[model samples]
Target: MKIEIAEHKKLAHSMELDVRWGDMDAMGHVNNAVYFRYMESVRVEWMRAVGCEPSPKGQGPVIVNAFCNFYRQLEYPARLLLKLYVSDPARTTFETWTTIERLDQPGVLAAAGGATVIWVDFPAQKAVPLPDWMRALVL
Candidate 1:
C-alpha cells in the first residue's frame, strides 16, 4: 500500500546515501526491495540518533507494517537524500514517513514510504507504552 505523509508530520531526520551498483536489478534500476532497505537505513539511523536502538533485553521500536510508492526509477551512481518524518504518536506506536529524492535532481521524488512502528518489550514479546522522551520527540 502507498504511504502518505500528512501535513502535520514532524520532520525527524534526513540523510544522504549513495546508491550502490549492487542495488540495481537485471532491469538496470534499483531493485524494489532496495527501496525498503533505503527506508530502513534512515529509520534505524534516526532511531539511533535519538538513542532508541533496540535492545534484546529491553524495549524498543518494532516495525509492524511498512510500504513504499515508487514514483520514478532510481539508478546507481546517484546520491539519495532521504527525509524522515514522524506523526500520530499513540500510547504504544508512532508513524514514520520518508521521501527519497536524487540529489542530482532535487525535489524529484524517486520513492516515498513509511512504517508503523510500535514500541515493544522484547523479553515479554508484547507492546509497551512509548517512552516519554520518544513521545516528545515524535510529537
Candidate 2:
C-alpha cells in the first residue's frame, strides 16, 4: 500500500539522510519507529528552511496527525533521498507528503508518509489562520 506521488507536483524540499547502524532492529533492518523520526527530520528542516520556526510565545505549525506506509525494508549503510511536498492549504492547516528512496537504489521507493499540519498559537494553545506568506508558499 504505497502512497502515490503526483508526477507533476513541485516538491517542497529534498534532503538526504544516512541510515545509521543504531537505526537497525533485532530483525536486522531499519526499525519501523525510526521511519517516523526520518519524517520528522525532513518536516522540521523544511519548516525552518521556509522561515516557519516555532516560537514559544508565537504561532507555529503542529502536526495533528501523521501516517506512513512501508513498501521495502531499509538496511543500514544507506543514504536515503527524501522528497517533500505540500498541498491543500486551508485557513489553518495544510498537508505535507514525503517520499523516501535510497540513493543507492535510485527510483525505488523505500517508504512514503504525510502529516496534517495545523497552525497554532503557542501561548493560547489554539489554532490560528496561517500567515499570508506561509499560505502562499503551499499554494
Pick by TM-score: which candidate is best?
A: 1
Worst 10 residues of 1 by lDDT: 1-10
* Model 1 Cα lDDT, one tens digit per residue, 7-122: 89999999999999999999999999999999999999999998876889999999999999899999878999999999999999999999999998888889998899999999
**lDDT leader:** 1
Backbone clashes in candidate 2 total 0
- After superposition, the stretches of candidate 1 with alpha carbons farther than 4 Å from their true spots are 1-5
| Model 1 TM-score relative to the real fold | 0.95
Which pairs in model 2 have colliding backbones?
Answer: none
**Model 2 error, position 92 (Å):** 0.6
Model 2, residue 47: C-alpha shift (Å): 1.0
What TM-score fits each model?
A: 0.95, 0.94
| Candidate 2 weakest ten by summed lDDT | 1-10
